[model samples]
Target: MKAVGTSESHADAVAICLTQADYKGHLCEGLYQLKTYVDEVEYGGCDKDAVPTILKESPVCAWVDGNNGLGVIVANFSMNLAIQKAKKCGIGWVVAKRSNNYGIAGMYSLKALDAGFLGLSFSNATPLVAPSRALEGALGANPISVAAPATNEDYFLLDMSTATVAHGKVEILGRKKLPVPTEWANPVTGALTPLGGSDPSSNYKGFGLAMFVEILCGILGDSGYGPYVRRYGDVHQAANIGHCFIAVNPNYFAPGFEERLSDLMNYIRNMQPADPERPVIVPGDFERQHMSTVDHQGGICYAKDLVKICQMLADRLNVTHLSPLI
Candidate 1:
């Protein structure tokens, strides 16, 4: 896939570049697809504008109208606004409606962390989850993402859907032309399992969180809920998905919030290793490790087909081509 460099520092640049590629590859693709068929797009009554004006509207927020513009670009624009507001006013919030798939929630939350503010993001997706037991789909796999700064290490990012595994992970597998893990999907009915999904492991906890997000983003915002929510990538229908973002300045609660966060994390770090070599892990640990691996390997990997699709879109938009990460 195409990649580009930014003036930000190494870590910051890595995060930014990855997010940029993801936006173009995932979100932009969906937007371009939607725009082809739809005549008018509405975002809380606002029409399309470049990324800048979208961010200026602030807390009451703004919408893309998508006309259906790229939801990824729209979402990226909106989340960036949240990060900016948090940096200046100690917190920022944004919610997006009539937007399509905007890629990973972590990418957005991490934006706030990169900007030195704690980032909190949540979005409600089309209904794919069943509450606890019943088979019929009634709830969503609503997801939550958070990122906080850590002085001794990379930022701590926690990104997960309330469901057992995010539908995105499943979609990633589908994109790979690979079969989903046996545990991850129901073999018999082709239905996705909920967080608890009969495993009784951490799935239930995820399921609960998914429900919580559904309420916060969907119910609270008065967006479509339950069976009414539409699916993504469906050219025939509009995606009425909703999202919520909350950015908080640690300095507001305590003068040395970052220091305190580091200290608390240190305490957890020094705990006896479950295995002497493996050591204990914390939130954001896996993603941080993944980033390092990608760096050493010279670049991150994306599905080759997806890369081609991105090139095709870049050609269509007449935007300059993006260089590969390597």
Candidate 2:
């Protein structure tokens, strides 16, 4: 990112965020988005050196202006402030406007979890999803993530897009010339419900979740919402993307929260599987498995195409191409 003119701190922030995405196996949000972010900075949609500033604040909340900065930096700053506020007041909510896309919503939520608080994060994104029954796109693939700690450093992390899938995943399938699954952004049925079926009967639930995120991040953050958000990959002007981060201390509500959460998760994990070969898993289990694999391998093993993409980016920036370690 620094090679593409991002400031050192901002570059670090973006790199760290993407690295987490890769570790968690959300490749679309990880190294895959690096070139796009470079385009955003270079083409004038985002300011490389801009700093996020708090616009208003109370003991338990804050409003921030991202100053058209990189989303990773803006999100980090806002969530950090929220964590600090939560430390004193038992809860904190911070919202920011004029930020670019953050890598993944779970990254911010986990920050609070690491700080011994439950975290929920949301962000309004480029408009690509149509609301239920709409002919054209009217809503962003607004994402929501919640992370709660359990015993022995375990956690319950729920991170998902309000849309059937985020646009990046669509682009990924398109690039590979692979057929996208029906529930993975099927235009025929439109958006799928969060319940995992393409059945239109429950589709409104997905639309409602999208609206929930838009209301908090876009409206509350004082950023663009609905059609007001810029189209994806449009570098024509600044994007008024919005994000919201929340941290809440469980001690304020109940005692032994982590223990209770652990018990619940363990019980769920031990339940009988519908298919004997595939066991039911909890929210963060998939990500945890991915992380474990990455750890065992000592690093992420990029696809051949991904490495080629990185080489192209390196050449574009007049930087040395990264070589495989093994």
Candidate 3:
């Protein structure tokens, strides 16, 4: 496939360096992720050396073994399979096992959106969430994402974690040396609060949702569940994480799905908000606005510390260092 946007070398360098610096992990562990992909593909992971194997298949559904390969590549393969099936059967469902962290869940779902289909993606993660009434972490901040196309090249994309907040947010706070809100997480204890906080009535909803993801991505996929999954950042053993992808062809059921979707989205945007200062917005408004600003600025704006870290990584890897634009 012809590449668009940033090249892999540039993008992976920035991503690894930033994640290592902000998340405060061993630099080698971060760099090892890229090596892992190459090793799995060229060595022994996939059936055809980096290519996933179909464990079971049907007209509209299939199960794939990632062969302990890189999560991103395996996820792309799974989603493409789902999209191809949906093109023929009007709907397609695919699940994968023995994968690793695949970065943003929305990326996979957006693949379907690019193919002019509704997309849904889900994945189980390393356990970091403390279920309601629990004292320790048991469930992961499993993520769910859905994307649907709209008229005029717009889209409605919702990508979020089941937890009250993603661990990456906490990592960002830590990098800035800021304390988190009590409802967000307990830094000292390392216990993340559920989506609804400590209240049993509402918190159970998040707890339930987390379990729902576990069932779909873990239990259903026959991969590890909850605490059974390897610890985050542990690269020694195979992560064996599970993921689910689904694609639905809106044209199969309705002739004007995009029109109705666009209308509803427009209506929601126009709705009045009780807090006028914080205007009511839809799931994808912030991302669209932010993307527009980035486009106007010419490129991404990285923090000074992140730039320094990337420079150090460049020196260590003997690659071209990144220069600041502003």
Candidate 4:
């Protein structure tokens, strides 16, 4: 199939690769993810040669088989399919099995916003989260994202993992030589705390949400569930990850959806802050602000070490090294 968004330009690939590299470094996950993708492509784990197929379809629902293809490409195709179905039936829900990691979940949700529809994206990942009372990791971070368009090209986007904190955050702490918060994880055992930490009352809520995502993405999609899924960077086996995408057109349900959403978001932003210096902000504000800064700078900035890693990746892949734009 054709490239996901626009032209199949080498520039697009370079930008994405560099952006992911920057994200890996900033997120403090090191270059393992970039290496994983490169190794997957080289080993045929992410079968760029294979094509995604629709296993079943209806006016408002569909099931897709990613054939262990690249997650970004497969996810884009799935969301586009949902958008088309929503345009015709007022709503669309699509699920895919045998997929790989699809990077950021918000990217898929924003795709629906771009089409003037509210969108939700969910995916099951390698197990990293333990149940409230459990010590072993039984659930993945299991991220969920939703995006709704508002007036003035604004959007309400919430993308978060069901866990108390993503595994990457722990890695970040480790990289900085900082002590992990007791509520975040058990440093000795390496078991992650749920969204509400070890508290029985709230931790269960996070565990529940994680299970909810697993139900939709894994069980519903007929893919591996919980620990059944392979380790993320294991190239010997297919990831067999699952994803779910949904799109809803506001026109089908209510009028003035965008206006009302914008009004509420603005109200929230204008709310009295307990700390006046740090104003109350709604979800997606930080990301939007960061994007603005990056746009002004013309490109993403990365640490010197990350640049070196990217240069090494370029050498390994025989691609041009990324040059500093700033």
In model 4, which regions exceed 4 Å deviation?
A: 1-32
Q: State the weakest 10-residue window (summed lDDT) of model 4.
A: 1-10
lDDT of 2: 0.87
Candidate 2, residue 130: CA error in Å? 1.3
- Per-residue lDDT of model 1, residues 196-301, tens digit only: 6645455566567877887766666555666777744344465556677777888877687777778877788789997899877777776667656666776556
TM-score of each predicted structure versus truth: 0.70, 0.94, 0.84, 0.89
Error of 4 at 261 (Å): 0.6
lDDT of 3 by residue, 15-107 (tens): 644343223222222333443333333334422224567899898999998877567667888999999999999999999988877766777
Measure candidate 4: CA RMSD: 3.6
Residues 94-123, candidate 4: write the lDDT tens digits: 999998877778778988999999999999
Clashing pairs in 3: none
- Identify the superior model by lDDT, candidate 1 or candidate 2: 2
Estimate the TM-score for candidate 2: 0.94
Task: Give the number of the best model, judged by lDDT.
Answer: 2
lDDT of 2 by residue, 170-193 (tens): 776777988777666655634333
Clashing pairs in 1: 3-323, 66-69, 162-206, 162-210, 164-195, 195-203, 196-203
> Model 1: how far is 82 from its true place, Å?
3.1
Q: What is the C-alpha RMSD of each candidate to the true structure, in Å?
A: 6.8, 2.0, 5.7, 3.6
